[model samples]
Target chain A: MATAALTLYELAAADAALRFSPHCWKTRMALAHKGLEAERVPWRFTEKAAIAFSGQGMVPVLVHDGETVTDSWAIALHLEQRFPDRPSLFGGNGAMPLARFVNGWADTVLSPAIARIIVADVHGRVHAADRDYFRTSREQRFGQALEDVVADRPANLAAFRRALQPLRRALAGDAFIAGPAPAYADYCVFGMLMWARCISDVELLEPDDPVSAWRDRLLDAFGGLARSAPTARG
Target chain B: MATAALTLYELAAADAALRFSPHCWKTRMALAHKGLEAERVPWRFTEKAAIAFSGQGMVPVLVHDGETVTDSWAIALHLEQRFPDRPSLFGGNGAMPLARFVNGWADTVLSPAIARIIVADVHGRVHAADRDYFRTSREQRFGQALEDVVADRPANLAAFRRALQPLRRALAGDAFIAGPAPAYADYCVFGMLMWARCISDVELLEPDDPVSAWRDRLLDAFGGLARSAPTARG
Candidate 1:
């Protein structure tokens, strides 16, 4: 399958085994969904020199057979276009853009909501070299100390759940966001939850919530690929 | 085209030309996208008996030949399956469900936000006979008087605009939510905008907003079907 040539630089925590960045998980799940494997290189927040060639400071920089693809959405598109013979990440025509809306909701809405609940916890899990950098960068972006950002987690968690009504309604008639099977849209939202799942024990979704059930299905997909990620919960 | 037997029961305002219900507008645009015309029937809120045969008190009930289909999503699927040769509303395999997510967002998020700002204005536009029922029912549901619900519309308007970041982000890459062309997803969000357009003079979208541009494109689609709707600003 020529898997040896494919590489993905993924964000790692103090424990190299803990790869928890939501954006990177998106590429991870997309690779699994496409039945492709890549040598995952553990990257830390302070290690810009490792991915300097990509001209970006993101963890999900993909080096596919020497051609680099950065950004989760760009990586997914590269896989879909390069591996057309494989299963489709976008089920049909026009689905990609609409799925982008789901991606937008996850990025602009869901991820921020989840971050507000777990950003401080995430600061604790970063490697010693990356810890101060992560905290400062994130605190500056959020305009709050990392600890204060998550002070009202219980209330924030409730808002997070309410923010999922669109997803809940989307799933009211289908098993997945892309319908019938998990696709890029599912991965987009799942990646955010996977971020929460990989680092924290804060139960972002209730055990019985439809979204939780949906996340369970994805966690069990690709032979528990996401579920196997190290978490504070365990 | 054998379009003679289809009929769509749509909600009407006091003048009967002001068709503002968001759900009905979805079916309206879907039918236009299909290039199949229906004899539009003006059904007021109090005229439940007009569409009782569908076993639901909804204005978007579509009677095609001897069969009746209620609900916008159901009607869209029905139209797609029944008119396979028409312009495809979903575009591809998983698109129906992803489009449903857009539908869900429009229904649960966009419409509610629009209602918070313009619902009281809608009360004044309903048929005289339905005014009392509309005011009472909506007030009871909102737990506030008709006027009070939109008393803080200036603030609600800000939140409404903020809530549209996902849509704004989605449209950032494409001319429409469904990509380069208009489809059910575009119609779903457009329907909500049309609801605001049909009954309120308050501007929900800025002139340069991407969503406003997308709405303008749809208003120009199908020979200006949406643009022809009587708007309060007119």
Candidate 2:
């Protein structure tokens, strides 16, 4: 007589005016694609103490209602269960397996390398315009040699291409990483570098690459919305 | 009254193996704790390529009946759903949230830094003795000046320590990262650095840290069970 009894709770939403982060952006982008909206809570860099309240130690945490959802993958799982009708962000049949693989690749392979590449580029050549952000936050982490990270960009970016080679191979024929449409894996990978692509000259991906092109398709789907989403927050 | 032809597949066993990874050890540890039996398949260096057949990029994957489950986190999820009677590897009412958070942190925060320190140390000082195992795998990706990576180390390791500062606060009085018993997060973090500790002459985790003590407790619970298991044919 009883089903799973899974009453869905909306996680941090876009309306909260939260500072966009790579981790959060991926999930948000997924929500955008899936047409599922949740309440947003802006996470500030200075609010380290507040953020750590979950004890999971980061943002993009989907607190389905009051109980916090940890890990982007788990959040993805939660999203699918909550919104089964719109579309399976993961494909239907064989695509689920493919999605599983690509998702893992995103989390394990592309995510970490892209993170390093993003930071170096963002805090380096791009952030020169707004030097204080880097000087304060990155300085605390990497100290003074932020210059070296920038200096070796030609080489480091080469490594980025190398790291991305696997994704390139995986997404060669498909419109998306898992299948014909963008799934959770697509958003997860795209989420990390979007901010860098947004604020800086660093083009980690290209419109030519199928993966990049697919991302453009998503942008066309969302950018009109991210742009038109009552920017004045009425 | 007829069911929807549900084939009640009574708990089938699966086989999962790692390619000389101590991180893989955690999966084995769980299998042992649950007393779940699986076939063993040991792999070599780039020998992990076969894991792709499982529709995943890397090990340690669990193949149950016909379904191939990849991603260690996903495997744990599958195991919990398929086998719910085991002593919960994810502890407490908050176990799921804790598992997701800690598991994510283990991969993101701890593994990257630990991997850097381990690779630099292993390839720099101990390359000769370890030469037999890793003939093809180079110390650095694309030969990107290990010196730059190496040069980045002192700073990187310091930042690594800073990341750990959050954990120190998390584990001040708690027996585990989330509770008294070790959970998926503990194993996840432990798995990433297992080989680093086993192979490295110097201590990887700070000797005085509560995490070190916590890790030791986990080690005792594991009791070297992860490294060796009885194979189907053995």
Candidate 3:
């Protein structure tokens, strides 16, 4: 177990790997938003042995200072806590509840909808035979089904759009998911959907909607985090 | 949208709730450990609402002060950062990595293992009807899984037990999941297993093992929380 060479607690701050994940992209953006420098390690999905030792087996794992953060949600929470100064990823004032509500709404509603498209599309497109592998793994890991997991993809996507319409209206052409300042939640959802776009199509991102403009705005807030990398000290 | 009565900014402290999760008990316990206070809202299973609003869906969802945090991993990260003055749930010195390693092990290996049995048990025994509700709701909401959507109970239970064996062994003689002082990961995993126990059989606890005793310590630590609500003031 070549575990996290440096645990999150070991480092003075987070020194993490972006891990080439869209989810990791969110954490990196949050870190950048907070102006914290982190180490970036690129990991492959096929190599289970790479992240085998860590508790959570997903991407975008952040090792703050030295503590390893496995999931993107966990990484952002860690960053927010580690760095409370500068720009806050969580919205301010009334936006907090908006942020919280949006946060939960996305977790329970949007992501799963997107995940169905993500896993099935990505797996079907990329690893056809490995679909069984993916299915079996998820079943063992989450006890969820891969095949027929969703009763209807179209309905799922439509409902997903409905659930997100509130946020889109909330965005109402605003630059972020919650408000003027992008909260951490924005980055997380952005990363996940971005992955969908990467594997599937940009149409999933919704053309001409407030979300599109909002995505552009967030990119502007972080100075195109998707395109930038850390300085040497990072 | 009653929303948060307090402007998100006005909401001092926060609440961390696991996603419809019985597993995030440890996060609540850690809040108790740090003497930090936050609101408590149980999480929802559907990912859309959680994600659209929060960013991610999985729990323990933590609203620090009022910032929306998703995933148990994130909650722990937030806790340590928000309450830096307190002793870390990970541990003091070199033990941080060991604690983290174990925590990850639990999440990746132990959690899923425990989840197989837990979800199957919960879906079948306690939530037979409710389980159908969730599946049906998913179908209605996302148009996914109209076909019974029954989890492979026997296979899952066997897999769950297989996953639990190693963890059960680790806890067989230990005082806690980690040591005398439980860490954040312990709470994450503990919350999961305990939640399973809450709705399922006590036999799942394995009294001879350390988790049985460790649970007591967590209960004690968690028994008293820095409730944002106070009965009286001078």
Candidate 4:
């Protein structure tokens, strides 16, 4: 029995050192949780050609054992099955659906809310070649200039914080969202916060918020994997 | 060993047969999932004295033997810990926190959105002795009449449906939110729907929506426990 090489194409900022796509971060954390290290190939938004082999324009594309898996959620599921002897990504199969719900919440609600507050900052930090593409697509989707979308950031920040009440309440009596230890559910949310921290200056959460505390724990997990990641936030 | 006798005080409408409180419904579904039956006692909002022994004014108070439990979340936890051999409500201890997050989301996000759409209907259905108390307390909280709060129901309904994107996305790949089988997580969302159905004529979900399908399955679960329950929705 032989193990195959693993590689992950992750979204990167202008510096290339700044790898910060929320979806990609989820895959990164899941890999670390399984005690596996993959070569992270830095990818820019305009560099769709690099990931074409995966048949998708988006990344967090994982090439494992010469097999291609796209989408962060699918990659996470793949890792769990491939490394059953390692720490379980979902605690057990029964928890998978619940974790999926949390994954959906992060994708549909959490990340979208955070993106509105940091879209301008994200545009500013992208590679020069990707700036126009980023702005045009995002601006059209939002139906406004990125600058205008983020102009009322103070209000956006409040709304974002208010949206976090459920997470805060859940963490009040537990150490992590999945219970005693961090799991895929924690990764789903930390990935979003890491994305915000890596490419934006806006502090989406207050220092005292329980969610902020939970984020701190995740940052310190896996030998400070997320804490050591490149950041644009001061 | 003798098992403790269990009795649940559930919220009821003027008819006493129409039990509709979302929190109470959570407990009901949980008990049924565990295959445990408890005597259901009808309680009205103004009848706080009936539950005074629990040191709380809320319904869904569980009295087992000489022990008393208040709050739906607490009672669910108690039942799981006390009846370990019965069907697990959260799958396992590891899934508890994730279920708690779902519980919190149902309480803070789902129920509040539904409330704004059906509050006036709720006020109209409570026991006559409780109408003034329900209307006054809720009106004061909203800073407007209940009718005014729900007057623009078309807009409120749209917002409520939009808020369900995550739930809908989660159900796309699985039959239940907790995955292949129903669990506490399913109960959390179903309870809110039960509240709307029991007290309001308004349709909170489109008939073709996946969420509605999931709700229908829950209604038919546990030998039609929820299905047999009274509903005001035609």
Highest TM-score: give the candidate number: 1
lDDT of 3 by residue, A1-234 (tens): 121232221101111222224555666677778776655555544545666667645565666545566765566666566566666665332222223323444555456667765555555443343355566775664456655654566766665565455455445433555334566657756765555554554255557766777666665665666534331122
Can you list the residue pairs that collide in candidate 2?
A: A13-A39, A13-A40, A18-A42
Arrange candidates by lDDT, highest first: which order? 4, 1, 2, 3
3 or 4, greater by TM-score: 4
Model 2 chain B lDDT-worst window of ten: B4-13
Model 2 over residues B1-234: C-alpha lDDT tens digits? 121111111111122221225556667656656666666664433444556677645667677766777766667777667667777665432234334534555655566666666565445333243444442354334254444554766676676665565456446535755355655656766676565654444456678877687667766775646334322222
- In model 4 chain A, the worst 10-residue window by lDDT is A1-10
Query: Across all candidates, what is each one's fraction of true contacts kept?
Result: 0.89, 0.00, 0.00, 0.72
Q: Score the docking of each candidate (DockQ).
A: 0.86, 0.03, 0.02, 0.79
lDDT of 4 by residue, B1-234 (tens): 355588999999988889999998999999888777799999999999999989989889999887999888999999999888888999977788888889998888888899999999988889999999999999998899898899999999998998899899989988999988899999999999999989998888989999999999999999999989888763
lDDT, model 3: 0.50
Question: For candidate 2, lDDT tens digit of each residue in A17-111?
Answer: 32335566667777777776666665544345655656755666676546667666667777777778766665442233333334444555555
Per-residue lDDT tens digits of candidate 1, residues B85-190? 9889999767888999989998888877899999888988888999999998998889999788899988999889999999899888888889888899999989
* Each candidate's interface RMSD: 0.9, 13.4, 17.4, 0.9
Candidate number with the higher lDDT (1 or 3): 1
Clashes of 1: 0
Report the error of model 3 at residue A29, Å.
Answer: 1.9
For candidate 2, give the lDDT of residue B44: 34
| Per-model C-alpha RMSD | 1.3, 11.8, 15.6, 1.7
Q: Which stretches of candidate 1 lie over 4 Å from their true place?
A: A1-4
